[model samples]
Target: MVTTSIPTTTKSWTVLGTDGFDSLKFSKDTPLPAVSDYEVLVKFHAASLNYRDLIIPKGQYPFAQKPGIVPGSDGAGEVVAVGNKVTLFKPGAKVVTLFNQGHLGGSLNPQTSATGLGGVIDGTLRQYGTFNENGLVDMPASLNWQEASTLSCAALTAWNALYGLNKLQPGQTVLTQGTGGVSIFAAQFAIAAGATVISTTSSAEKGELLKKLGVDHVINYNETPDWGAKAKELTPKGEGVDHIVEVGGPTTMEQSLNAIKIDGTITIIGFLGGVQGEKQPGFLDALVRMCTVRGVLVGNRVQFEEMNRAIEANKIKPVVDPKVFSLEDAKSAYQYMWDRKHFGKLTIKIE
Candidate 1:
């Protein structure tokens, strides 16, 4: 309506069909749609890949279908145009796309969950995107596009895991299970909250890096299969940790249980560890420790805003993989994410 950039063709990568990674196709002249009454146009500067980007392409993700759409959830950009009815954003405002476009606040529900960007809807792999005004938040001034792009999913999920049930308190201990985006974010958030952090990793090199990030102790899970017990022992008085960032799902849950205290919390975020007949956690597990086991989706819009304020205030920077990729190499970036060698979020610049 009050247009700065008019409706025109833009470049984008689209999953043409569900043929695994081979289905991803790029085009320079993808037709850009007109912004609706409440929609705003964004010129995406950067986007980060999540595990979903790896699994969804292979039809492996639960409740998520194959890609007939643009496939990126985390992105940071600047508003280039606004619809007549849009008031939340103006042209040139830096913004980050919300992971779930429909769920603004309160609890996440089925309908709201289905509104995940790059899943139920077209996502941020394009040079330009149009989103509902409610779907984007003001980007933190302290972060550049690359750092801000990591927030929509990984950072938000970590924030939700730590702060959802109860705000993480100072001096509590946290056990993080790897150096992935979510785990690193958890460690950073915990440290920022004045909490002690113990992390688990397979590589000694990565462990040293974790120490550099201010992790109190790094356990090599390969050597110490019972790292959970070791983690508990490291806690003050051997009581166990206040929170366990449970990314390993079934295989690592038992370890998590061992590392948790009688009323500690375990937030299940990812299932990177293969399910090798590890017993599914049951009521007995909860009964034994009287601990809370929660599953975290990314987060709601209000929480995203809250996390942004904290990140900006504390100058918390998201760890991004140094290997850069351009929009043309997004498919290759997907393969890199699948390799799981990168320490943090893999990103693509839309230029």
Candidate 2:
């Protein structure tokens, strides 16, 4: 029932190659693709940055195909066009899409086609993008584009790892690493679930911030090189933590394993520390001793909806960093994230 004015064409930022993102290129000549019966066209208002965007230039991911691919997976916007059969969202509604197009409900299927925005397909960094209605969720009344953008990838991934896979309990202890998007959301989600959360950071200042967010313990990894042992010591059982939201990959994998309870769950999500680094000793034995290790891909649309419900019900807010950039400064945002100086989610505001 919501009807709105239609625009002829939109301007968008395009990632040509390793040279980095080119700003606000006019796309007046690029004709809008006709919406498929199940698809809707979105006019993006804001988008958030993730580490995945940083790897496209280096060719670290094989799926990142040719040049001219727009690179951003998380964003929120208003619906400007809807195909005949699109019933979930109508034109003029505010909505956000899942990071993964085809993979829904933890099941992989070719029906939806696992094409990722900004990688296999053009992404939302542009002013206009099209997606299947099934992949889109209505933005909550309380969230703006920036806040809704943060929910697509990082928040959903943490939700699935802690609640979906681990089913973390109210009194369970959770271990998280660093202050990056995923780790910070892990901390927030665990706290909201009434779980005891312990986080590690290289900066004491960020650790203090985490403590204020209801983190039960914050370990300064710089001062305590064996922070995993410290995490074990803090648990009520004095054994180890119940779950670990692992993001540091091999560099922190051994330590994460060491910090977990005998039958604890460790959800491996990213390689922020180093992709190919060596893991600590006793990893195999640790796994044999009843530990659960899982590699998490950012979740699907159903999980995104579930996470959004929790966000609305519990009144949880994402800890977004203060740095805001225009669409033109997206490259600078990438550089800042690469430097690892950001305390929380880094974002770009587009109108």
lDDT of each: 0.90, 0.80
Off by over 4 Å in 1: none
Over the stretch 237-312, how does candidate 2's per-residue lDDT look in tens digits?
Answer: 6888999999988788878877889888989888887766665545575656478888767787788887888888
Estimate the lDDT of model 1: 0.90
Q: Give the alpha carbon lDDT tens digit for every residue of 1-351 in model 1.
A: 877857598888887766689988888898988888899999999999998777777776776544478888999999988999999998999999999999899998888988989888889998999999999999999998898999999999999999999678999999998889999999999999999999999999999999998999999999999998999999999999999999888888988998998889999988888656357777798789889999988999999999999998888989998997999899999988888868888888987
Looking at model 2, report the run of 10 residues with the lowest lDDT sum.
Answer: 20-29
Among all windows of 10 consecutive residues in model 1, the one with the lowest summed lDDT is 58-67
Report the C-alpha displacement of residue 14, candidate 1, in angstroms. 2.1
